[model samples]
Structures are given as C-alpha cells and as structure tokens.
Target: MESLVLTIPQVRKIVLEAAGLARKAQFGIGIEAVYRIIDHLGFVQLDTNYVVERAHHHVMAARIPDYQTEWLAELCEDGSIFEYFTSASGFLPMHDFRFTLPIKKAFKAQRKPLTQAETNLMKQILDRAEREESLTVGDFENDRVEASSGWWDWRLRAS
Candidate 1:
C-alpha cells in the first residue's frame, strides 16, 4: 500500500467545510475529530499531540487553513517560522497574534454597571411584584427589566 501524506492546508479546508456545515445545522464539530484526521494523515507529531490540540483550538478560532501550510508559506516568504508546536503537531507562529481586544474604551464604557439608585429601584420594583403575585422573575437583571417594562403596555395598546 502506498503511503499518503496530507498537508496542513488540505486538512484545514476539510475542517473549515465541516465546521461550516455543522454551524448551518446548529451543531458542534468536535476539535478531537479534526486533530484525529490530522494525525491519521501523518501531519501531526507523536510527541506534541497536546500542544497540537491547543494550537488547533487557536487555529480553528483563526479560521485559517492547516498550521503547516501557513507555517510553510511563512517560512518560504520570511525564512523562519518562530512559533510553538507540540511534539505530535505542526507549529503555530507566535507572530500571528490574531486575538483582538476591545479598542474603543467608550464603547466598552457603555456596558458599565448600573447606578446604585437605579439598581436598587429595579430590584425593589421586581421584588414587590414577585411578592404580590407569588411569581418568579428569572434573571430580571440580565433581561433588562426597564427596557422590557414596555412589553406589558402591549395589552393596553391593543385595547
């Protein structure tokens, strides 16, 4: 039997397609499955399996093709791939720091904590309503009670 060697790019394409299909159907594609395929294709290292798995998680988030292809391309162009890799897996260069941070402080400030008075008022109102009606108010804080208070006015509007 002839041995077949699969490159990182080829495996990445397959993983992306599979993930896309899974996403469309509202299902999850296991990371283990993707790594197993990579291992089967002899692209992963036997000693760096754990590192490869971690890198796979990072790579999947990158939405990039296989690590090897990217690494090779970087090497061909830049001559050195300075990154970490598991003994059983390929390398992910440290330079490709793709994680994005919230740049706009103003935008993040919009999600700031509510004022003490506002929070107390909301809690008091909700507590009174729950006590009077013996009703459960699930996650009122998370669901934004003030914003959703107008929902009750729908009945009055209809009448």
Candidate 2:
C-alpha cells in the first residue's frame, strides 16, 4: 500500500479543522444538539479535573453554546446515553455498551486470587448495590481502606 505525506503546516491545518468539525464548534446550538455532536464524534470523553469545567460539559458547551448542562444529565437518566471506558472515561451511545463488555470480562478474569478479606469487601459492595438502586465507594467505610486520599477519600468524580 502507498502512503500519502504532507508538510507540517498542511498536517496541522487538517488536524485543526478536523478537530473543530468533530466538536461541532463551528455551528450553532440546539435543544438536542449534544446527541448529534456525540454521535458525530463517536464519544464524549469524561474527565475528572475541573480546573475550568468538566471536560464533557465543556465539549458540549462549545458545540451548543446556549445549552444547559442539566440537559446532558437528563439524557443519561433517560437512557439515551451511557458511560463506558474507551481508553478513558467516555459517554457513548447506549447501544455501544456491548462493545465494552469484553473489557469488563477480561478485567474480571485477570484478578489475582482474592484474600478472604478482599472477598468479603467485594461481597459487601455487591450486597449494598443489590439493596440500593445506586451505590458509591464512599459507602464502603471499613478497616480495609487505603487510609489515603483517593477514590475512597469520598471525592465525587464526574464520569
């Protein structure tokens, strides 16, 4: 197969234009604009840091300048969109969930033999999730904690 090559400037322009088009930043906003944008871009990657604003929200805002963040939340609640890992935190079409299942299965398969205490910890998490409609790591308070500022530190990350 033959490959086409371009100068640095040409490559940069193409990349910039592609990035803008992918985000729909060059266009105007609409009520359901996020769906089109995410669909076009394939996935709206989720980010934890908010030194300015959450990544997903910022990405949507650039495209739908007049749209509200709550709209994205509603989309998630209505099951129109879903979150999955694609090299990063990502919001993708609900139908794409099937693609991520293999990753989950592989992760489960690779775990080391669990110590009895770790097994109990896993059991507690599952039991609570079964009882509660929703759950968080903060609910897992116990001696089995890392005793440091991480997920168990009770910080709510956007995903």
Candidate 3:
C-alpha cells in the first residue's frame, strides 16, 4: 500500500488549525513553533531545501496573514529564518514567526519650530560650554608638570 502523502497546503492547514487552537488556548504558539512540532513529528522537511519551496510551504501551512507574508518571505529569502532558532532543537523554527505593522505616524510631530532667539541662545550656551572645557589628552609627564604647578603639588608629591 502506498503511504498517504499530504500536499504542502493540506499540511499547512493542519498546522494552522493546531496553531489557532494554541492561540485560542493562550498557549503562545507561533508558526515556527508549529513547524518545529511538525518537523519533530516528521511531517515537514526543512533541510537544505530551496528557499522558494520553504517559503511557500511556510506560508501555506503557517497560517500567516497576507499583510505579514511579505516580511516572512523576505526573512526566508534572506536566510534569517534560521536565526530565530534558539538551538539545534527542531522546534526552534515554529517559535520564529513574527508580524510587524508599518506605522504611519509623522516623522516629526506637528510642533512649532524653534524660534531664532531660542536657537541663538542654545548656540551661545553650547559655545560657552565648549570654551569652558576644551578636552585634551595630555601625557603623564605633562599632567605631572601641570599638577606640580598647583598649590597642593608639594603635599601631593610628598604623599
């Protein structure tokens, strides 16, 4: 008798159903985590496979939404999918799934720009601070010379 083989879509459906159940149960199961479980069960193969094939299988079986598919695809394509694994543990793949949303907020919020007076004041303060402390790395000998010129130099040298 021929062994029953499930197509990638069918396998993905099963995995996705399992993941949904996990989510409903608040089990925190992710697609990669599910993939690890499936891989351990010998239901899915992810070794040395073509990137496209791996991505397609992941997309079909992982239940990832269309909005997040592009990022997942990119992760797979860029070979970063493996980085999500914690160890050589086969279950690492299932925990690697992530979803990101593009934020549309303004880069700079609607706020009044700095007034010319404020800018000038800031510049003046910065200039004063810079002038007050011009950092310089002096040699140990030079530091000793400067220190010796101070009133406490004799006492410090005696110590």
Q: Which stretches of candidate 2 lie above 4 Å from their native place? A: 1-17, 21-28, 112-114, 119-159
List residue ranges in candidate 3 displaced over 4 A. 1-16, 21-45, 50-52, 55-62, 67-159
In model 3, how large is the Cα lDDT of residue 7?
98
**Ten contiguous residues with the weakest lDDT in model 1:** 92-101
In the range 1-159, model 1's lDDT, one tens digit per residue, is 999888998888777665443233222234333333333332322232354354444444343233243434444256333233333335333333232124234457788788999899889888888788664344233434454456433222211
Where model 1 places Cα greater than 4 Å from the true spot, the runs are 1-100, 110-113, 119-159
Each model's lDDT comes to 0.43, 0.74, 0.43
Write one digit per residue (lDDT tens) for candidate 3, span 1-159.
899999998988787666543233222244443433334443333333465555435633444233233443454465545332222222124333432112212323545789999899789667766787653223112334344555434432211
* TM-score comparison, 2 vs 3, better candidate: 2
What TM-score should be assigned to candidate 3? 0.19
Global lDDT for candidate 3? 0.43
Clashing pairs in 1: 44-88, 45-88, 45-89, 46-88, 47-87, 48-86, 48-87, 48-88
Q: Please provide the root mean square deviation of candidate 1 (C-alpha atoms, Å).
A: 18.1
For every candidate in turn, the CA RMSD to the true structure comes to 18.1, 5.2, 20.9
Task: Give me the overall lDDT of model 1.
Answer: 0.43
